[model samples]
Target: MEPSSILVIYVTRIGDTMLVTPAVRALAQAWPKARIDFFGSRTSAAVFRHLPFVSRVGVLTKKRIRFKGWLQRKSYDLALVYGFDGDGPFVEYALRVSRQVIAFKQRKESLNQKLLASIDKTTIRCSNSVDYLFSLIAPLGIPKAGLHLSYVISESERQWAVARLAALRDGGAGPIVGLQIASFPTKGYRDWPVENFVELCRRIRSEHPKAHFLILGGKREWKRTRALHVSLSGCSTHYAGRLSLRQTAALMGQLDLYIGVDTGPTHIMGALHRPMVALYHPSSPSRALAPLEHPCCHVVDHPLADRGATEHTPMAGITVDAVWEKVRAALSGEFPPPLVTPWTP
Candidate 1:
């Protein structure tokens, strides 16, 4: 494979971008010599740093910014874009700049039609967003199974995380468990009750006397994390909203295990191949988002065991007992095989 110039665009939040890694890896493996460039939102750009196959990363700001004119000026050989109608401008950018453009073939909505008109190939019914983009490279004979996930952490980041943990623990424990208690509050039903977490931590400590728990989450989740810590009464250390995204990722890598809701940090842990117990509610697409490529990951689904008349919601039905069972299973080392190879690119 010659080093053809290629541009890949995926503009989504942290978790969505992380999901794209497997597809990225597939392209890189299939075209080892290609100069692969990635474009994503500023927040997601950090996730792509140090990725092996990425020669460069372009940060797309807001929405509808033109990287196409820039890439067109540079004359890249290939361009791939993810997202639906809202992403048409990106497809247009790819079409204008690269010799070949490949995009998802969604409903022939005007936006998709417009994007399709600009691109050379559009794939419909590629359900997995990442897989959809990777399939475009089939013309180059890249095998579908070649896709995998990759994320590189700096040695400094790892050291920084270890030191931070050491400082927090004050040499009390040798290994810590990472716990993230809350997902976004809007989807509050997705959250397992904080009391359940307190109970889980108590049991874990009883089973492994020397092990401590480290709570991680965003600022909005800080209060819940603190409450859980208080309930544990020194059995756990709260580090919620305190670390940068990458730092948190590095911290997660150092932990013996991770327990969290269907959230971004869990997805990051998934990328690192860290063992995890992910809690999911009917609100989340657990089958879609749970760690796909890592073998040591576990998922707990609780679809609101009871619902009153005239009330319906995805996560509101999940129960704590179901979550505990999944967590216990993960601790016992019974985990599912990754649904897909880690996405790399």
Candidate 2:
């Protein structure tokens, strides 16, 4: 069956939204002529911009779901909804706007019966999050296109990034490292200690001498990032609360290396194919969440990664020396050869 118009709805956090790109890419590859539209959270919606295959991106919220598609015709030939609970408003909205709808099995048996195909949420077929999300389209028989996350940085944004980096460097040639110090409040256990970062930066600068750092995060992390900036004094720039999500990503593209806790920007950096050392907490280990088929990714997993640690597990188990070794290897161009061929759109 040929689907001329498609709608994909996934309203979630920034990192989770990035995780869905592989599945979306597979859909585009299978239906090259289809016009695809995306619905995401206001912040996560920015990720869909600059993608060649996406025709439009709109914001979606549970609050705005009431009467949303009641006034319109069923405009989409196929629709897919992700991360919605059983018989939720998001599922109802998708049913109203599309000829065929696919989603995870809802709580109510009646709602599950309504979907074109309802995926069993507990099937446990995939080891990683990207592959798990891709399962939503398995009933459609679309071949997997790629497993790596997707992000497009435009030429203008690239230029802006370059210019910003130049200004920050001020003619001094040094390895520019970007750092994300904290995760969101709920995922605080995923964050490595800020003092560990300070010690790591000190070690990196001692070896490279000319190395510089870019402190990156949202306003919630401002106090800690500020302290690190103050400790680094002349060598680091604080960008924690200053830029929008896209702007932060643009600057991240210009970095020589990125060292971060597993978070949204780490996910963005994963898509850029740049040198990076990502620290993962045991609760959400690198095997499950790290970028797949990435050429330069260096993962530092916590000691308890295989021990079935809970969210209460501290990320400090991933030491400064462990992360520093990866950082050093990345800076020296000692990355292992690509294990798998990188997927292209």
Candidate 3:
């Protein structure tokens, strides 16, 4: 089954979108001649840009998918839809645009009958997200290419980030640490305390003396990030609510180290393979979502992670001292070497 053209539809959050990269890479490697186009959420679509394996990237939304591909001929040899929303239009759009479609088993048996393959969600039993997503392409006989998440920053974006960081520092030379203060609204339980962040930053400063901080997040986190910035005085720059997703990622790629909660930017930082200390809530421990094959990954999990902790559990259970030790190790380059398998080009 040599597919000349393929469409991969996955409209989801930034972190979830990042989780799909390995599966996409597997598809690309298995069929090098296939033109693989990705349809992702408006916020997450940009992350697919500059990937060498992807032919194109476009936005996918529930509203816009209503009539898409209805009148068009079957333009793709195959299409794969990634999501559990059986009632959504994503699978319908894929069916219209491709000769063969694959997706998770929908609630409607009729829809399941239409798919080339319907994967049972419960059959997949992987603790790590990268492996979980990579399993989606197994029916195609495509072996896993790599376990690490992939993100590409263009040379221009890198240059722009360098300039922006320099200007923000006003020619100050020091270790620039990026901080993601909070997760999205509903996942607030994953956020380590802001006061804890302040103490961690102070400890980092005391150790390096010349270290500078770049506070990163969305408008929802503005107040918390601002408080931390104020606490750090002249040594920190608050970037919450001020940058685009791509811009945030670009700046993230330039960080000497990144310290963040288990969130989107942490996923982005994971892709960059930079030095990072990610604090995880008990509910969503690092075993399930931490970056695989990361060279300098430092994970600080709540003590109750294995004790059936719930959303009601506070992230404060993970202390600053525990995080500080990981930060110190990351700063001193004391972690083990990255275990990576080279992807086939």
Model 2 lDDT, full chain set: 0.88
Q: Judged by TM-score relative to the true structure, which candidate is superior, 1 or 2? A: 2
TM-score of 3: 0.96
lDDT of 2 at 123: 81
- Candidate 2: clashing residue pairs, number: 0
lDDT tens digits, residues 226-258, model 2?
A: 999999999998999999888899999999999
Which residue window of length 10 is worst by lDDT in model 3?
336-345
Worst 10 residues of 2 by lDDT: 336-345
Q: Can you write out model 1's per-residue Cα lDDT over 1-345, one digit (the tens) per residue? A: 443888888887777778778777777766787889998887688899888778998787545575437633647777777766553676667666777766765454553554423333343344344554555555455554443356788899989887877764686684578998887666566677788788777777767787788889889987898899898776677789887888888889888789888777777887788778887665345555666657787777654422232223544344556666676677677887677633322
In the order shown, the candidates' Cα RMSDs to the true structure are 4.4, 2.2, 2.3
Q: Which segments of model 2 are wrong by more than 4 Å?
A: 337-345
Q: What is the TM-score of each candidate against the true structure?
A: 0.82, 0.96, 0.96
